[model samples]
Target: MSLAARTLELLRDEGVDRVFGNPGTTELPLLRELATTTDPSYVLALQEFSAVSAADGYARGTGRPAFVSVHAVPGVSNALIGMNNARRSRTPLVITAGQQDQRFLRDAPMLGGDLVGLAAPACLTAEEVHTGADLLPLLRRAFARVRRQPSGPAFLSIPMNLLAADEDVPVPSRIPAPDAGPSPAVEEAAAVLRSAERPAILAGDRVGATRSVAELTALAEALGATVYPQPQYEYVNADSEHPLTAPSPHFTGTEIAKALAGHDVLLVAGAAIRPHVWTPERPIPDGVRVVQLDDDPAEIGRSYDVEVGLAGSVGATLAALTALLPGREADRERGARIAETLLRERTTWRDRARAGVDAGGPLDPASAAQAVADAVAPGTVVVEEAPTTGPALRRALVQRDAGDYHNSSGNGGLGWGAGAAVGLALAHPDRPVVGFLGDGSAMFGVQGLWTAARLGAPVTYVVVDNGGYRAVSDALPPGFEGTRLGGVDWAGLARSLGLHGTAVEHGSEIGPTLAAAQRSGEPSLVVVRIRGGAS
Candidate 1:
């Protein structure tokens, strides 16, 4: 079998059910091989950025490493931002980019340049394959490194000629298997929790995605422990309204550390607890016991030396702890009271945000976001890349119980959002999928609108058009000048992409516009035009 076939075989062996990518001439050989194989699904994205994000989201949702294929130079460069986002979010992805044959690489053959250079600054680690035989080992190393440590994206490039070439190269030998599960340290963490006077559980992405909220909730309730959802990466628990929740302190940095330190013990579940999330000015109070449990080891003890570090499946660890922790009525009563308070707080906040928000003019970005969120049934899927307005949008679209809320992650790779919406829409057609994008983000993958339109996807897009790359410009740090990205015409672009499109400048036009798009039967776009700087 050709190296392309063997490489594909390897991916299949890795249990990759699908690959999300955009191809180029250099990747023709692999694409042909893909056509011959039916085990791994191939998802065509409009751009490399979208392809990478699709892979990222796929990994995040399915809890397995996903593959991404893209061309060298131009394509890889376009995909860099999304890769960066994946790295930031620590989403596992194995990315393959096409490279010109090594013979002409130094001479700058067409579409040939420094791929490693372009990718290294953006991805976790990137390398090139020198020979067909080099692939098996490199693939093994790359995949393992990305999965084992930090768990982000790793890149492996193949020369176009070699991928299509025949050689004395035998199919490469298989490598070591990947290991994932909770560890022996669970007993130690439970011991700490059991002995503590006041304990808290910090929930991160793993806890949320692994469906470990029940265990976490149980542990918290059994000990009267406070449960705080770490706002970044992953979120746990159904909602702040759910019973058996103890609201964590709103303060981060020094205050968070102080609060955590003051406690007799703190159990960090699914949280990286990296320096960025904690305070350095004041250490966690003296004598505080900090225990950590996570699926990935790299995140365990990243900030402070962990008293107990357990590496295992989040679900397994939570199950063990829940089984061991006997219920205490005093703790249970405290937890119920906290849950009630949080529910009240959440209700008050939602009511204020939802009040007449439907009647706001020119469609206030926050108000519009709230309206769309309210209209959707729970359990509806959302694909949103509405940058600049993300913080406000997140608040207004408070994800309550039911459905999944997906964004571009922390990567902020603009173009990936629309295409990811497409993948998610295809992944779960039974649930309605809605994508919200700022004009700038929409520009990145609007090509996807046409693809979705053609597929007859039930995907609806809410375009917040303010005429510019609002986030990019404002995100520039102090003293940075000449911040201008010109502008993008979102409505025109959407229509051009073969999706039924409309621009609504007035608030009165929003509900009807969204309602029509949602029921359009085919993929459609609704662009809400706003005055500049509305992000």
Candidate 2:
């Protein structure tokens, strides 16, 4: 078998079923080989960045590494944006590129500059295989590294000579190694949790993945505690309005201190206790008991100190806690109070966010979000990265089912939105995937829009443009009066990338625009210009 063909088979044996990519001349050899391989299917994208980003999303959703094939130097450069996104998000992805023939070592071939250099700073590991014999080991190491705790993207460069060479290398069937870890600390933490009067638990992306909610709910109820899901962790399916969910009154130093100070014991399950969270405006209470749980050792108490730190599978930890605590009457009573409070607060917050929107200016971001909400059928997936307007978007969205929310939780990167939308659409093509990205973030890895257009994907891009980097506006930079840094011709930008784009300037225009896109069943976009400034 050809080296390239056998390598693709090895990847497929590793449970990587898809390669999302964009082809270039340097990558042509691997592309042709990938095309012939039966195990892993190849999906084409219009840009290298989108290809990498899509692979990131596919990996995040499926809990398996995805492959991306790009050209040697230029393709690696373009894919760097996504490589960074995947690294930040801790998504397991293996990006492969075709290098110039090995014979061009002394003299620089057109696309043969240092490939490892381009992918190094952006990904977890970047390696260039010198011979066909090195492919299996390098590939194995890349897979192992990317799947390790604090998992991330990795890269490898395949020279043309190796791709075409006849090498007798042992290609073993890939069996994914188990990543299970000890959870003894979880039991000890539960012991601490049982006796506390006022306890709180925070859920993150990991919790949303497995048994986070049920276990946390049990523990919170038992302790008569409050629960908080960090938006930074991508909504833990714990709504801001849920009684079980605590208020993040402010992210500022003063505000966070006031918010977290009341709890006597705080358990961070699958969520990070960022320094800003515990000691925001004020130093956290000196003796508050803190327990941190995560599968990755590197992430344990990173931003905040933990009295007890547990490293193991998140679900395993939660399950162990459930067994130890069993159940408690005080927990149930406190849980009831939390539910009642959550209902009241959720309604109030939703009303407050919606109040100004259904009334003011040329268009309201809330009502505009609401329009998209109405236009979307249930079961559709939403990949949200609209940080500033996150509260409004969450309030607007009606779907609360598990996995309906696509999280870029660990890394709040901008380029993740557009390309991630492409990946979700590819993974679940039957469902309509909407990307709620702000304009500033849109520019980060927007080449995905071109990919969507080329695929005629059923995903829609609903850009909330308040002009400039709205996230950077803490209330005007130095000179500007309002929030806008500048104007972005959203529709013009989309059209330039080959997507069917439209401009929606008023609240009334949202419904029609969304309806048309849904009806067309094409990759379309609606750029809604709304007044900037926090709601």
Candidate 3:
């Protein structure tokens, strides 16, 4: 078999049913093989950003490595933003790009700039096969490495000429991921938690990535710990509406410090304390003892000093800790107190959200988010990229399922939500998907709507049209120019892309439009103007 044919066969063996990419001249060899294949279909994106982000979302939804094959140099560069986001979130993706023909290397051909060097910054591993016989082994290695602890994007640059070469080669046996058994420090971590007078847990995206939220919740309940999802987390760390849950102070070190103020023991579970802003206040409060648990050993004590570091599978370690610690029955009084505090905070936030919805005027971000939250279905998957609306949306929505929620990664890349929503819908056809995007962010990924329309993915895109890059403008000096955006017809753009599009004129229209679009089980877009910019 030709190398291209063998590559597809290997992908099929790995259970990758969809390959996402944007085509280029160098990629034609592999595309020819994909064109005739019935098992692993080619998912085309208008841009490389959408291609990579969509694959990232698919991997997150399916809990396996998703595939992407971009063109050589420019395509790889175009996909880097999404790649960085995937790397930060630890989404397993085996990304490949067709390099220019190896024969012209000394001549410095156009579109032949260093593919491996360009992609290495965003990939866990980036290498190029020197010969057709080496492609299979390189791919096998990438697949295995990308699924290891702290799983992330792995890249390979395959020469177009090599892919078309006819060579008989032995496919290497698949390397199975090693089981991360109980951590040696689980007992020590549990001892720290059990002895604490007041404790708080910092949960990360990996909690949901590993499908360990239940274990995390149980551990939280056992210790009566207030669980705070890490800032800019990519997945559901804990249920938003759970009584033990506390709001994340995303991007702000001072706010994070405030959240950690009263806790004596801070248990960091699969989370890194990397607040975006620079503030004098330390993220972890002074004199607080820290017990950090993560499947990736590098993440433990990565940003702060830790009293105990437990490196093992997040699910297994959390389960072991829960088993070692006293049950919820022992902490009934503390649990009740924490529940009351959370309930009171929730009530205040809801009241504010309700007050922000004025029928005669544009809705506030919280109100708009509340409407989307109200409209989501029971098994809905939500992907968020709205900077202004994120905190409000998190407060408004209630997500209980392990993988129900995801967001743009800490890399702070925009344009991820639309493609991610499409990928999620494709992965879970039975579940509706809602993508909450800031108008600015939506424009960055507008091309994804076409892919969604083509695939008929059931994604309801909620564009919170705040009239500008309000997140940036709000922080900039008052007279900063070029941040304000106006007069773009978002609904019309969606309609042009062949999805159901509606412009929400009032707050009352938001929920109904979203619900109807989701019910239709087709790609759709709802644009709602909110009180931001000059609005």
Q: Provide the TM-score for each candidate, comma-separated.
A: 0.83, 0.89, 0.98
**Relative to the unseen true structure, what is the C-alpha lDDT of residue 6 in candidate 3, on a scale of 0 to 100?**
88
- For lDDT, candidate 1 versus 3, the one ahead is 3
Candidate 1: tens digits of C-alpha lDDT, residues 1-535:
7778777777877768787888798898889998987678688777788787767766765667788999988889888888888887677888989898878777888999878888887777899888777877787677767666467889988898878876555544545645666577777777877887767777766776666766676667777777766643333343544554434433346655654664778788886543333345644556778888887777777767679988888878877876777877776776666667766765675576566454534555666666666655445677777755554455545454223767653444567677777766766767777887777777767667766776677788888766565545555663343533345566676678778778776665677777777766568788776544523
- List, residue by residue over 187-208, the lDDT tens digit for candidate 2: 6888788877777776665676
**How high is the lDDT of residue 506 in model 3?**
88
Quote the positional error of residue 506 for candidate 2 in Å: 2.7
> Local error of candidate 3 at 227, Å?
1.4
Which has the better TM-score: candidate 1, or candidate 3? 3
lDDT of each: 0.70, 0.73, 0.87
lDDT, model 3, position 50: 99
Candidate 1 lDDT for residue 137: 73
Alpha carbon lDDT at 251, candidate 3: 68
**Best-matching candidate per TM-score:** 3
Return the number of clashes found in candidate 3. Answer: 0
Q: CA shift at 340, candidate 2, in angstroms?
A: 2.2
What is candidate 2's CA lDDT for residue 143?
A: 85
